[model samples]
Target: MGAPVIGAALELLRSPRATAALTTTGAGLVAIAFTLQQVIGWPGYLAALIVLTLLLVASLIARRDEIDWHWAILPISLLAYLGWAGLSLLWSEYQRVTLISFSYLVLVTFVGVFIGLSRDTIQVIRSFGDVLRAVLLVSLVLEVLSGIIFDAPLAVLNIHGELAEGGPISGLVSTRNQLGLLAAIAVVTFAIEWRTRSVTRYVAIPSLALAAGTIAFTRSPVVGMVTVVLLLAGAALYGIRRLPEERRQFAQYAILAALALFAVLAWVFRAPIIALFNATGELEFRLKLWQRVLDFVPVHWLEGWGWIGIWNSASPPYSGLTPTGGRPHDSALNAVVDLWLQVGAVGVFLFLAVVGLAFVRSWLLAGRRRSVVHTWPALVLVALITVSVAESSILTEFGWLLFVICAVKASAELSWRSALSPRPERPEPLPHE
Candidate 1:
């Protein structure tokens, strides 16, 4: 009786509805990690992660026989990147920290892999859409309560409640930039949800408005830039998707050329553009910090000091790099630079290959696939890559999770191994509840 009960429990956990719920819950928790840490503290956060990790493992075990197994084949670029990060433990100056940090990275990666393996592309989008809608709603409610109802800060959650002031509300994400990033991603997700007819207009319109309002209030220059890029990317994708197959190749080349030209023009007028966005002060500060970070690069230009995903102000080298009289910088504030600092130049190459390949594959799919849902991964990658210019969020936490999911999903579609092997018939996507 006991054995049968245990078997039934596993079977239930592996059911489609159960997997969708678990995936959404995991996404929401990781998305609001800063809030969780602030509200429940690190001990609670760690406990939540452990519990979620255990559930994920059990779900995977229960579905093992049903899984294609071949779907587990990851891209070489992704494997190389992970291998390099793990190998850093051998020479990492801070081995213990590296081990712990790498473990955390693996933990999140496992969740991403589970979701990618368990769900189809549309299901993944639906999972994100459902969680993000709730997250944005709650964030707006808190902002209104703190900014208007009470006119006070939610210090515990780091919400400044600045909605009444017409700017810079952190919501539950802790920082304006972070909140803006989430809002920007929300906008993409909501737009796709509307286009796919996944949600009724009644739900989709309000969600879009909520995301736009959040982005506006956050007043983040980084997100402002990302929003512009997203618009252009969406437009480009729309055009490409409408083109004939033969013309699409040419259109892609034209778009690439235009982007290259735009980059050059942007750099030439960067100062004026920075002033327009009122980000001059922010740019100056980042410049100074980046110069300081680069100064240490030569010491370990090849292998890096070690892989500590988030900087530890208490640790060596990092301790020395803290800004004078300012709070310790949690990250290098740039993903490429962070990669160079933590894992070295070789690591940067591998990191780029992972994202670069994923983006290319996703982009091509978006152009060629008939469904609008294919565009989500490509657009999300655009946001991630754009934000990475000024934020190192992509190296850890929610950013890493999203990255892994997109990479895995894209890989599953275009993987050379899959092409070489006898492909199994894919399971029908579970009906959306």
Candidate 2:
């Protein structure tokens, strides 16, 4: 390109407004791309991903000097996991499937890393807050049009979504469970924005109310329970921080002990709980699925089938009940199982280390700062981990995108350069505007 054109492009990329707009737009596009594909076709979805990747890369190039690349080594876990996933192409049942999926995942991963490389934690929170605000609102409008206004759900890509018992709503995503999960995440994001005073109460309160309303409409029991638990945990975090510095460690240990005990109790009484929620039959089906997966792991104990290709019905195990379990598999319904099945047991271990370290690092940062904005990264990681229990939230789509952002940001904060030249102590009640 000519100098004049190149200079114009650089100028646009370097603008602060452009940075903010790109972050917001990229997040919005990723979240809505699946729905758009369902509506229009695959082209729109691919176009959105391409545009998002281009914008993020251009923005990263514009700010190359400011970012501390030496510290980039801290996120090696993430890169390593992706590298292994990509390497699976060598032995995959179908190279084309793995190549396409791995390429897309790699692009999304870079977009997330660049997002963190360009902006600090608070800036990311603000960008996501803005993006999610619009998402929840749009979902609400769509749900009303489909279930209440038109009384006809939009079915695309073989996804059935609409009103269920209790007049539950699914909105644009076309699944009550997914809608419920998204709305709960919105509630968390909005709550953080409110606590941090990043947005005015007039805006935050109503947005939160809308999100809560949508969650109720979806009536996803698992989502509802998880939200309640997360809220309690957030409150506990605040309470723990209120202790004297010397007593804080003791308080944390006590809290962990209590949580462990509670978990054990829940596990022992799981049968009753499932029954209470009218989910025992569903639990039985999932148990069978889990058994089948366990039975097949020994076949490819170490290297796995292929990171991305194994999920397709065209692949061996999943293809018409060819042996390694039965057909009609749509997701392990668990992130751990999904990874274990695709990339093997070692892949699962690496995945845990990467994400686990990120969450712990972010949690430490949040405790030190005790700022609402800082707390968001840790909480976002928590949401990802919790939701992964029943959904492949941390492995694909927007969930995976958010996971990369959190992992990269937290890793950046723990870098050697960061320790040597720490960010200035945050001002009390840091200004958001």
Candidate 3:
């Protein structure tokens, strides 16, 4: 009886016209809602998790046609080692804690690959961005309303200088830094779309404004935001310098537009914007954190205490949140530290090789001047790598989807016509021989 309901529900979700983009965005919203529910002391997060998990399962089953050999192999290889490390050290004091931490990584990696590589992933991501943009816009509007209708608390957005500390206006996201990172990536996505003229300048302009709005609400977006701009600008400059004389004008115009856009962003968020530059404490903390991580190398030079030991060893058992015996300050750096700590030299080598190959491929593909055909996904992949430095997106659903799409796009480019063409009939070859 219970099984029938589950089957019907899955069927409905997996239907052809169901739209994975909507499904993806729904998952994000549910996750956000879940986080907020926790802050508000509600039990909604569990429900949201259940719903999103079911949706993901249904979406996969419906879109089973998209699966490939590499999709399963890569993530499985990474997680298997992580699992083995965790299980091997289960007798240790940190066993339970280590399992939790490894679970987080496994979830992120699996979803990241799935979403990053799916056939319509780019489209799904674009849709997800649109929904996120709308949510941010509404939040901004509410901030204005709350300011006018209510008072000081909602009016003045508190900018938490530290990435670890997080900001005040973050809606449902667990960290202010994570929310800010998302906003920054949203801007990068729109910036690329706008530069390519796939989306109207009107849409892109407001999207930038929305990004600025999100940044104003959360101060830490600047680091990721600035890095994204510089990277894209550098790529554009490289592209333009290599362009023929005729195409140079368009590049020139694009350069000018980028300048104008940044000028506007800087002007609008001038106060909080400058604060990002002024925060010495935050900068000092990151420096100290990195140094501490380096110090651990001599001690845990070989196989680490195990997968979860870094956090479990801490007093409160929360990595950055606890501020005790945790591995590192940043999520991205934590991955690096964990790799070195848990798997030793071999794991580190494998990790670097995988990331390096993906990046090199994305760079070569994105840098192509002849076609818009290949450059879009390549550019997105490049952005993913850059953003991965600040956030663990590459280890999550978003990263997986981005990687998968690029892989599929590349595979699609193969010359099928040659393979499909009928072979010429053999005539008197046997007789001649």
Candidate 4:
């Protein structure tokens, strides 16, 4: 009886519908984390995450035989970073907070690993599209109710109900910039869905329009810059996909060189560029905050203060770093700076390795794969990385979840282990539009 019951449970976990349901739920929760925290508070939010993580772990164990163990090495940098974070507990200024925060990070990472290992790239994209569509639709409806219908702010959710005034609205997320980032990612997912014909035109078109509307209303300069970068990246991938295999390698190198030169030129003309984005005020605020963070970094320059993923208001250094009226700042507003403050220089190097390798692998896969779906991960990474320069979103919650999924997926395909062993057979390519 026990054996039969256990077998049934395992069978249920292996079902495709079960995988999709879990993926969508996980993505939705992470994406609207701030909303969840505000609505249900920390206890409820943590409960939901814990439940989701347990279920995903069960699913992963049930399908353990299906995963290629060699691919474990593919996420070596990520593992190293996490390991270093865990070790920081020994030296953590606030050991209790570090333990709690690090646990939250692990829970989110497990969900990402499960999705990456279980779903194909197209399936992952579909799951994200479905979740984002629902989130954005609900956000818009709430904005309407608050701005036009009730004409009052939703104080609990931090939504100012400014949609009626052509928002700098926060929506259901924490800030206008966050909403804009999610909307930008939604745009990429919706476009890929349309190109792949994964969804009908009726669905895809409306989804794209909704995402675009959200981005326009948010009025976030950081997101605006990210959107431009995403467009350029999409165009570059589109062009590279058309090149012959032999010339593609050369083209890739040439493009990299051009991008490096462009980065230097952009830095040289950063004053005008800052004005162009209308982000002069935003840049000034970040520069001041970053300077404060840097000043404190030398105290623990090598190992950092500790691995508290999100800032704790009661903590010593984080509490006093920046003044925001009564509100506590959660991040340094720069991912690299955040890393330097939390995990120090070594953590920063490991993190760069993780993102750098993930982007290169996904970018190459985008160029070589025939199906349009392959481009999704690369474009999404472009958005995430660009936004990271101005926001530390990638270090926690939704941003971290998406980064892990992309990095794991890319590593599964392009890991060096593939060359050492027989390359695992992949699913048939979707028909190119």
Return model 1's CA RMSD, one decimal.
2.3
How well does each candidate superpose onto the true structure, as a TM-score?
0.93, 0.89, 0.64, 0.95
By lDDT rank, best first, the candidates go 4, 1, 2, 3
Give the range of the ten consecutive residues with the poorest summed lDDT in model 1: 424-433
Best by TM-score: 4
User: Candidate 3: lDDT over CA atoms?
Assistant: 0.51
Q: Which stretches of candidate 4 lie over 4 Å from their true place?
A: 1-3, 68-74, 278-280, 322-328, 431-433
Instruction: Compose the digit string of candidate 3's lDDT tens values, residues 177-257.
Output: 555655665666666556555467889899988776676567664344544564665577567658876776666566656
Q: Cα miss at 398, model 3 (Å)? A: 5.9
What's the lDDT for candidate 4?
0.87
Worst 10 residues of 2 by lDDT: 157-166
Task: State each candidate's clash count.
Answer: 0, 0, 14, 0
Residues 278-389 of candidate 1 have per-residue lDDT tens digits of 5447776777778889988999999998899988877778887776685336887899888998899999999999998898888887887777878889999999999998
What is the Cα-based TM-score of model 2?
A: 0.89
lDDT of 1: 0.85
Pairwise lDDT winner, candidates 3 and 4: 4
What is the lDDT, from 0 to 100, of the residue 145 in candidate 2?
64
Task: Give the clash total for candidate 3.
Answer: 14
lDDT leader: 4
